[model samples]
Target: MPRYEYRCRTCGDTFELSRPMAQSSAPAACPDGHEDTVKLLSAVAVGGTASAAPAGSGGGCCGGGCCG
Candidate 1:
């Protein structure tokens, strides 16, 4: 299973859910029972070593970024 981030457009709430990849884009109601929620196009932290960079800092070096 993969974790996904979603934002509820109706109630302006953000939440996460773990589901199969096939359900990544499925229409899902917010946990708060709001139906006008939509999946947010957000970056998921997959397998990798964690870093201490500040939030929004590019993760590559050598003129690219840190993560590169």
Candidate 2:
């Protein structure tokens, strides 16, 4: 299960919940029992090393920013 961040509009409190993706969009209540809460858009981070391209091998002028 992925954790989701939510904010209560009534009491202005932020909270988190661990639930399934299917219920991610469902309504959530804050710790204070405020039902006027909204789900926040979270940023996902992906990590990995990308292989570099060979030297002098690219789309030419545009790739090298030679187009002014």
Candidate 3:
């Protein structure tokens, strides 16, 4: 199951629900019983330890910036 964030247009309430991926896009109602609710686009984040930097890898321009 995955958690989904939704917002109600009628009552202006926001809520969350846990449902199967198959029903992720299904219609949902707000806690205040507002049926005009829409799912919100949420961000996903992954975390891990930073990798070691090679020696002599000082402040050199990378492709990420214009300095690359």
In order, the Cα lDDT scores of the candidates are 0.81, 0.89, 0.86
Model 1, span 1-68: residue lDDT tens: 78888899988989999999988999888988988988888865877547655556555464345544
Q: Residue 43 in candidate 3 has what lDDT?
A: 95
Model 3, span 1-68: residue lDDT tens: 79999999998888999999999999998998889999999999977548856555655556234373
Which structure is stronger by TM-score: 2 or 3?
Answer: 2
Model number with the top lDDT: 2
- Model 1 stretches astray by more than 4 angstroms: 44-68
Model 3 — TM-score against the truth? 0.70
TM-score of each: 0.61, 0.71, 0.70
Please report the candidate that would top TM-score against the real structure.
2
Model 1 RMSD vs true structure: 8.9
